[model samples]
Target: MTGRPPKRQRIEPRFHDGESGSLDMRLTAEDRPAAGQRPNAPRKAKPANRQNASSGSRSGPARRKSAKSRRGKGGRKRRGGNSRLLRFVKRGAYWSAVLGIWGIVVVAGVLGYYAAHLPPTSEWAVPKRPPNIRIVSASGHLIANRGDTGGEAVRLEQLPHYLPEAVMAIEDRRFRSHFGIDPIGLARAVFVNASSGRLVQGGSTLTQQLAKNLFLEPDRTFSRKMQEVVLSLWLEQKFSKDEILEMYLNRVYLGAGAYGVDAAARRYFGKSARLVTLNEAAILAGLLKAPSRYAPTNNPKLSEERAQTVLLAMHDAGYIDDDQVKVALAETATIVANRQTSSENYVADWVMELLPGYVGSIDTDVIVDTTIDLDLQHAAERSLRTALASEGGKLAVSQGAVVTLDGSGAVKALIGGANYARSQYNRAIHARRQPGSAFKPFVYLAAVEQGLTPETIRVDEPVRIGNWAPQNYTRKYRGPVTLTEALSLSLNTVAARLAQEVGPARVIDTAQRLGISSPLQKNASIALGTSEVTPLEIAAAFVPFSNGGYGVVPHVIRSIRTMKGKLLYSRKGDGPGRVIDPYSLGAMNRMMAETLSTGTGRAAELEGRPAAGKTGTSQDFRDGWFIGYTGQLTTAVWIGNDDNSPTKRATGGSLPARIWKDVMVAGHDGLPVSALPGIYEAPVQVAEPAGSGLVPPGRIGDDPGRPILPEPGKGRGPLNLLQRIFGG
Candidate 1:
């Protein structure tokens, strides 16, 4: 028995038969009849045995309960899983919101703290740059740019388009598109710094960099960074975009102590901003990154590599074409090796030192028109450095100086030392060293004024005064030597004798009158240059001999004027009048000329050009000097040590003479050769002192084949100065 096959019936919504002819009805799934069964058909089933029926009914109830239990368990498992997923999502969202709010609060606090330290933006104004001195050579060559800026401020429009473009490409690619601070760059920097765990990159926009340079200190703190941001925003609001860029290019530090693009160009490439080429522009643009580290002047090879990177960046930025990039990469850029310590600065310093005296005080930018021949100045520096490099080690010479002056006493060139950077002590004008035999000319001039001819024979034997006995450099003496010969050979005893006869006072007077401004000791030892004097002093003193007995003040700056050409100080023809008399001038020139021709200064001779000079070696070679003069130029060169140590048997005739020759040859390149003033030869018979004491007065030796002295015994009447000094 199928247990009545579970009674199946069909139920449909029924309407009353009298209501309508058609019945509206719908059959539902629960009301539908079972498969293969008619409505109410289940009532026909009958049970056979009571036990089997009971068993079948019991089994059906059990299976239904088990299925219900399984359904309940599956439903509870699904509900639990849904609850866990919902809790996880809700917790994650809660924490994410809390962290985001916390991050906002922290950023706001930091920004506020830095903002409090910044000054009010309303009170901001661009500070004025320090005044700069533009120094130019006598021939209008820019010798150097002086003062803090190191060069004149150049306008943005004055620069090459590629120059600013190059800087923008490398320093800030989105400079124009962004506001004062570049959000994109800052975000990128944040990401990079976060990954690196350090502040390795500063994503400063061009406007931000200008703000820092103009108004903020270079501290790498967040406070400084915030201040820079504030200032950059202010700058953007206060000025136009191009104006901001102008100020930026004019204020950026481009290494080598150069404050701006113009200064960097002048300081490094030795040019103006407008003249910067593609390669040079690339190199200068590269300097914005760790300026000194990548400075072309300091590290050329490394700078080239950096420049290549800049060129690639510029090309990538579309500021330059591929061909331009190739050209810049292939070409080389020249840079000034040292701008601060350059020899040109030495000259500029010297000129500046005198500026205060000439114009009282420099409170504004001024143009100094100097007499410095930049070419000759370079030659002087080269000669000094070359000499030091080649021989300074062996000769124990640590320093040297060179000063060249024109016939009118204008300083042509002046080098203070071997390396201006190593030592700024201007040895040329500040070092007071004994001139040794270079001083003999003054003593000889005194003797000649007192009427002793250059041809007068003097004993070269050892001479003593008090406890001092001056000996020859060779420690050997010729029995009889003419006064001319003695001065030529730098004979110490003869110089001492001449100094004694003329009296030390007369020698000092003569020297002071000529141009020796240094104090001279009034002792007999003055004959051998015991008095300390500067190379400039000695060089100026020799000017009288070259310029026909006229004194010189040794001026450097010819005129100082404003940039608009307003004269501040113009040097007039001012100097001490003629110091040496005509007769003595002729005699002195003859003797000194002999020294250059065949004596100690023979090494300093100019080819076919009449030259006269003196060689000076202080006692034990403490100083070596060669002060020589052409018809046009007079130069003095000194080589020694700062401590006054003796040289390695180095004499004035060795290094100083060679340097003088090298300098003068270049100095007289285009000048016509001329004869030395008052140089002449005279024929005379000297009555031997041992045979008859009668002598020819006013007759010096034959030098340059001229008669340099007046007629004998015809000394302006009866027993003039010459007749009295030497018996006629």
Candidate 2:
């Protein structure tokens, strides 16, 4: 067969370009050459394909499928990531909800635990404040306040506007808006403390502080804090903002034993809260943070600085404008000088001790009219403090006490110590120390009551009783001295001999009769003033000598009355009358007068006035004393170490006498000077020739000068004879 196959015939369908599109002129499969054969030759059968093929092998659809597969993979990958993220978020939310629920439960349980310890809601109420004791001086000037609340509670309306404003400004500016607890303040405090790495700010609102002060213990534990919070909420719910502020002002404890704004105002400024100025109010408010640290009486400069801070806070809080702040800064609060350490409080304390005895239990505020003269009290305090401050170190004397009284036994001024703030031991009224030679008056009085005169003679030589021998302070004996001279010079030997002969029991009786309540030892040493007694008692005992033999009980509270003016107590009369007879009184007064005029107490002599006092120095100079009195006033001054250590030769003739003189001078200012009772000119003694065997008309001398006579049962010897003559 020929290789060439059939010839191809071309047929074209003619159509105009405009009429119809050109038809296809290519060869059709039916008219074309057969496959697997030469061109135009006959067709052959197809062999079986080895390669596997399916619908997936189609290129057109496979390309499309591959692209679709790639797109699907990317979509699946994105969906898987989204699914993981969604699961993570769901788990986190679920755990967060669980934790949140547990946290709320724990907080609720903690709050419940603290709240359970509290009183029943219906029973919650402000506790009644302790009754106040307002002590006023004899001249009706406020001396001090004595009570749980140092001063009376003042109403909010009574206080100056700036006082509460200053407190609110510095303590809690959001006081009006906040609901008991201040979350914003707490958060701010936390942030500040955390950032500073220390506690510089407190989150306590005013309500919180009041709550803590009123109901909660002053502890810094978390439990206490929670309790404070609960109480604060309760307080806010129970009272209005103004009421809470008022309670805070009236209950918050300031320093120096003062509680409440009224007390603080009076304590620091010596004025009522109603009268406090802006600067003073700021100072009072400044004390809230640390009362002692910023107390005006303690550190005035620091207190002023703190007050300045308060002023600034007030200015910032819009309570005071810039002009007002400037004015306040310029007019820094003038703190009452020495208010905390004032000797007036000593008198107030003494009155308080006697309050219950007079008025029974103190359930209501009482006004105690004290015999204290504020001016004289200040004078005494200044004198004692000045002496101690200037010479205490040099003399090795740390403390001193002074007590002044009128002849009627009214305590005009009393200082218990050099600084009452440093020590509250009322040395004037409580401390029983050896009066030393100050007790000699009682001995002499006893001898006088037994018919001895001031002119009676006694030898100032060493005397012994048992094993105890009393020696003079100078350790020198002055022989053949009169009773007046012996008492004036405070000769220990003469006193000892007299007490031995007449019996110390007589001396005890004399002392007790003259208002000395302290127990006395019945011994010869007691004549040398070895017995212990309070300054108050010693001064009281000496009152009879100044007031013409009328005994006095040293009293500070002149009268006591409630705030409503109901009289509870009033000192009725002068005293237990005539404890000392005229004979003994005249003799003792003359002898003690010679002491101030010519003896050791000459330093305490009051000019142009007849004053009598005795000088006393305890053994080793541990205590120095000057107990003296004018016709109008009697004062006792004692200087010593509280620990009973010896001083640096501090004698009664020195610091104690100086303090006594200063106090007496101040006490007698503007008063008529009069001679002491029973003080008169001594008749001039005609000089007796030396070695004369005859005794002078009124003199009882040693042997040969006087006859050696004895009483019945007593031996007829010089010693017994002399004892009879001198001891009587």
RMSD of each: 11.2, 15.9
1-728: candidate 1 lDDT, tens digit per residue: 65767777764535534332223233323343555678876443434532355645423334346555745667668879999999999999999999989997986787777777776756779987776788889999888888887877777888889888888988889999988988898898899999999987769999998888888888888678877877787788889988988888877888877888888988888789889899898888889988989987678899999888888888899988988887888887776666667677778888888888988866667889999998899888888899889998998998999999987899999988888778888889899999999999999987776656776778989778889998998999998988889989999999998888878998998888888988899999999999999989899999988987778899889898887778999999767766765557777787888888899988888879999999999989999999989779999999999998899988999999999999998889899998888775223322332422322222222222222233234443323434532435
- TM-score of every candidate relative to the true structure: 0.77, 0.71
lDDT by residue for model 2 (533-573), tens: 99988998888889877888788877888888899898887
lDDT of each: 0.81, 0.81
- lDDT score, candidate 2, position 211: 85
Candidate 1 Cα misplacement greater than 4 A, ranges = 1-123, 297-302, 339-342, 360-365, 388-394, 479-481, 680-728
lDDT of 1: 0.81
Candidate 2: what lDDT?
A: 0.81
